[model samples]
Target: MSHFTKCELKMTNLTALKRALEDMELDYTEAQANQSVQVRGWRGQTLDASMCINMGKYDIGVVSAGDGTYDLTADWWGVETTKGISEAEFKDRLSQRYAYHNVLQACEGKGYTVEEERNEEDGSIQLVVRKWVSD
Candidate 1:
């Protein structure tokens, strides 16, 4: 319960995370304000999460790391055995989308317009942003 992997993910922006989850079309539930939900784990265990992604047998918990960041929590074994989705795969997918949303938000805040977005054959995303200049 509340097991966070040492992956290269440090979820800081809840807005970007929500956008990323929506981009991935995941079935998830966000807790109400000032409340947390239970995330099902292995061996009938559960952990509190601000948001939970349902994966049938097990759920991935999005919990606060208490360090101004959020980390993912779940029983990897149960999730993999039941859903056949590896931790690395989940991390990769979520990381990419999360970064995408984060980048877009940053660009927007800086008054940049996204000109083009393309997905490479190698599964990488390319984005082009522009800002108009006036004299």
Candidate 2:
């Protein structure tokens, strides 16, 4: 049996989330407010999802689990997309972009400027920011 797992996000900014998706070059659809999606689970069970990302043969769903939290709903059993990316890979990529977007915003809010940005060969990102400290 399969069911939607709660991811528990601290923040719920659809705009930021979409921006992360765009940064990752992943195609997604912004569903109408309160719209629900049907996600296929491991056991071929259908679950409710609120967001959909086009992953060729199989798509992943970002579902709202309430309290400003979202869940990644999908079938882990025998799931294969054209990209041949696993669920963990997809989530990691998305989280990285998401963190990047949030960190940039946070640093700017704290009067910090981005000094350098580097993309690691291992698909990781490195960002350096500087802020003027009053003496």
Candidate 3:
């Protein structure tokens, strides 16, 4: 007989996510519960597991496991990909590389205008903003 336990993992809370983002330094604006925000990837980069996890706060279907090792498929925000880092380490690196200050600078450099800022139901502050690209 084979036994398997179906464990349901809860989604990370907004406050936790906000703190993680703060640690990483990624700039983000929050939307209402029913609103969807368009996530802009850094130039020349595509969405990966780390970014997905950071953005969505859940483990997406994409993951790699080998020899008792687990790695996220995405780069840690502005940090390049490297081995020998644990999941927690990776999260920390993401925060350092993509810190809010850095992200805000990048956005301003890109000419994006700040739209709005507000506090979430979780008592966390969120920025609602966007930028327009000239063709």
Q: Name the top lDDT candidate.
A: 1
Q: Considering summed lDDT, which 10 consecutive residues are worst modelled in model 3?
A: 1-10
Runs off by more than 4 Å, candidate 3:
1-11, 41-89, 92-135
Instruction: Give the alpha carbon lDDT tens digit for every residue of 1-135 in model 1.
Output: 344343457899989999998988888999999999999887788888999989898999898888989988888888889989898999999999999999999999999999999999999999999999899
Give all candidates' CA lDDT scores.
0.88, 0.70, 0.41
User: What lDDT does candidate 1 reach at residue 15?
Assistant: 94
Q: Put down candidate 2 lDDT per residue, 69-127, tens digits, no spaces.
A: 77666653334435677767767777877888988888888999999999989878898
Minimal lDDT window, size 10, model 1: 1-10
Candidates 2 and 3, the one with greater lDDT? 2
lDDT of 3 by residue, 25-125 (tens): 55555544554333323453343222233333322111224243223343333332223444456555444433444555656778876788675686445
TM-score of each: 0.90, 0.71, 0.28
Q: In lDDT terms, how accurate is model 1?
A: 0.88
Candidate 1 TM-score versus the reference: 0.90
